[model samples]
Target: MRRTELFFPRYAWRQPGATRGDERFRRASSLLCSLLLLLLSACSSISPKETAVSKTGESTFKSEPPKKVQAFATPERLKALDTQEAFEYRLGPGDMIGILVWRRPELSQEGILVSPDGFLTVPRIGNIQVLGLSVAEVKALVTSKLEFFYIEPEVTIRVQEFHNNKAFVLGRVSKPGVINFPGKGTLLEALALAGGIPDQNKDTSLTKCAIIRGNDTIIWIDLEDLLRNGNMALNAPVRNNDVIYIPESSDEMVYVLGEVQTPGAIQIRSGMTVLKAVMLAGGLNKNANAEKVFVVRQQTLKGDVIRVDLKKLLESGDFTQNFSLMANDIVYVSPGGMTKFNYAIEKIMPSLQMLNLGFSDLESLGVMERLRSKIWGQSGFINSSSSGATSTTTTTSP
Candidate 1:
């Protein structure tokens, strides 16, 4: 057929290369992955430990460790906090006094009110300034003035009513307000007048109470010593306009976690021991390794980790292993094998987060109901019989 070697060409179908949309999608996915990684790194940078108390009683998490625990005021130091000079009640304006002269009835005066200018008009002596002077000083001044009239005049002055004096008791007390003292009052007396730190079992911070005087001077009052140890040395005499502040509990907490039946923070009280705290946490769980209980105490910036053999303390009667716990301490009961500190912390993080959420708030958010439903499932409490039928019918009908 001489068809010019029949020029025929064979064609092959080939797969298409990557399109523009595919490249764009790949870039977007890479960017999304980078953003997710960045978010994870940011979250991981936050500190896991919380030490400061929030208004909701939740601890504020901080990256930096707390400063070392400062030594408490010693007995000698606290005793020396009182002023060396004895406190003497001084007369001021608006004060009513009784001036009596024994055997000299004519010169005795009753209900002699001190003038607004702090002066008292005597029978013979003219107006004399008694303001800013103690009772004894006023008596001596009046006696000196009466010396001109009698051979040796004897004068006695007594405050009939204290009108110009007031003390304030504020912060975390049942009754917080201005308190008027009949005469000289002590720190303890003022505290009693203010209802002695509201809810002594829960809200009061006995170790952090303070007595503020004037504008700048502040005296720390260790109620723990005064109430628990019976050391009244720090109960200094309260002066006029003095303010006693009983702050709410702050660091008075002990955290129990890891293998405890109830893992959470427990309020600390006087003479709180590891055994007591464990019991307060509903005792150890079945998986708890009673032999290796750890107590991490924050004595300073760096915490002190104490290893306790609860097995020895409970079974062998070695009480030395049952140590007294301090405020802001962390107790962790291991799970049989050797427990790493970081692993224990990881295990406790969930409990701390739960505590931070606050049970009341969680209940209000219906989380408790959801949790209960999950626990009971469909067969237990959350009935899935008629409800299940209704759901199936609705889905099938739709």
Candidate 2:
């Protein structure tokens, strides 16, 4: 009987359990248990699927697809220049005035400067602060003052040089600087005086031009719309000390990395769309899945995310899908590999390797050609053989 029979007498014993047999059985049983323990230690641990998942599973970063760009259809607020509200011109310190005493030659004055305190001392009119008052108000005040002494007087007040209140024009305009408000001035007149904007001015784009007043007060004006539609309402007038700074259209760049024929930032002009940007990036590589083109646009208010399918737009010419690209947009074309690991490898590494290999092959071929030419002189093998054979024949005949 086996030695294990002695360890558990009833189970192993069809016969009697002797002392030696029992010892052998106990020894065999202990050895078997030790072997099993060692085997268990050497063997790979078998875990429940759930337990394995709990220990080492990771979540992947799947970016949200880009939403179709919606067309902004908000109606423009209409403005009428002719019947619009008359602007109120305010008086300030350091403004020059011309007070004409109509028909009264003795009292007529050509030039008069307002005092630092905003007061103007007129003849026969006790010192009065005309600051912050309109030209009409000043005329009325002077006329009232003259009533005390002279017969019915007619007075006319005119500003010699519009000062104190100023506006600035900068950027792509022919001339950019502080512009004085001659009267209630319109933006059109101001731009014209500044020599008109350059044809290449970025302000001509959809981003439009803006007017800034108090902090956080920005009024965006669509120059193209106003010019095309003749909307006088959008032609808001500039105020005193107002700055009109024009910015160059920023040369935006879109990165077209991963599985693209050319992976780099492309020059993005005004109104450039994703399809156009992709074309600039040299289009998709052979391995690229055209159906999986994505754009990563950074939003001012939201977190960064992957964007829409560009193929549909490109193929169908969907106006809505042709969204205007912002600065620094990243366009990624996916390589349709089955596994994530394969996808990354095909999209990111193999294509670069292929390009390198192609270059290396070209270089090697050039080197081989050079070496072969150096070893074999300018005359090829056939030419050399013929010449040698002729020389031998000539020598033998001679």
Candidate 3:
């Protein structure tokens, strides 16, 4: 697969005895070349090989491995508590319950659905907070309330529908819907119930996932960590009302900002390379410094800044200079003479400000909430002892 590159040099090469019509023809040729770049043909991989450009303007393939980046900035995923404090399915909104009083069929209620506000309206009792309480807990609460009105009242409550004891698996998955957990649900179990993640050819893939709980807290979970890396730590417990969204590959956009005609964002397509990204952004103008193109990526804290001499690639057909682009990658084609990194960043900042996605900070998952999730569990279980001490299986995210 050949990438059709049409390089129109800033200085037109002409003969000594050139006519006025000859200059017009050269201008016409430049216009035609620029138009051809719009029909770009891209070919690259997701994890591109590291090709570093030296300060002396030479492309060198590094032997060292690529830096390991944490998918989510937070260090650890949530851990489960001991079996003694095992996770019990708690009631939530939309859950249906059946209440029966001993020798009092008239006072009993059947299939009473919990309201969105987490309250259940009973026959005798007006409203009760049934949300986040187990079936055994509900029985105890009902018995106390009935004791005030009736003599030695015995109450038996069972989950009729178990509607709210589920996790929502949304986004680009095979079967996305509410997954019911009869006992306890784990991240892996929910994913399996939702028909697992799908492969969308070479275009877009289900690479990453997130667990959104109360207060819109998002904990980034790497799919690789679960499937390939064997990081069982990522298999967090699925709490009721928890939303697991596995976003498409398009969420990871490639920002093409620089001396290009249409400098903004290009949807990261399959085989998206540096040259293809530049071409898709309406190609470069005459002021574009083809000698020093930069791909500024936010992999780690300091950031991974790689320099690419694109002029050599275009003229000599060198694929080394045209490395692949990953998610959240910034391809900056500087104007002639401005090769310094800081200078290019200064020029690119203003353009980035207009865009919705900011490069200012990494997607930060709060710490205090993590500490809170570590201590207090969904159904008020103390998540103190880990798997080492207890027979705990469900790993959770804080």
Q: Pick the candidate with the highest TM-score.
A: 2
Q: What lDDT tens digits, residue by residue, belong to model 2 across residues 202-296? A: 43343456566556645566665666668676777677666666556545466777777788877666567777777777877767777777777
- Model 1 ranges with Cα > 4 A deviation: 1-75, 83-87, 98-131, 140-158, 163-166, 197-208, 213-225, 228-236, 239-241, 338-398
TM-score of each: 0.54, 0.57, 0.48
Worst 10 residues of 2 by lDDT: 389-398
What residue pairs clash in candidate 2, if any at all?
3-25, 66-307, 66-308, 79-233, 166-241, 168-244
Top-down TM-score ranking: 2, 1, 3
RMSD of each: 17.3, 19.9, 32.5
lDDT of 3 by residue, 1-398 (tens): 12221232223346687655345545555444443353232222278777666788754553444355436623343653213257777788888888888899988888899999899887787799988888899888888887889888988888878777688899877999988887678788988899977765446634568888888567777775676677777777777778999877766688998789999988787668999999999999877888878999876655778999888997898888688788778999878764366676876575455331211111112222222343443212222254535232344555
Supply the TM-score for candidate 3.
0.48
TM-score of 2: 0.57
List candidate 2 segments past 4 Å from native.
Answer: 1-84, 92-95, 102-106, 115-117, 148-153, 163-166, 181-183, 200-206, 227-233, 300-307, 314-319, 338-398
Clash counts per candidate, in order, are 6, 6, 3
Candidate 3, residue 159: CA error in Å? 1.0
Can you tell me which runs of candidate 3 are displaced by over 4 Å?
Answer: 1-75, 80-85, 121-123, 202-205, 251-295, 298-304, 307-325, 328-398
Superposed by TM-score, candidate 2 places the C-alpha of residue 30 at a distance from the truth, in angstroms, of 40
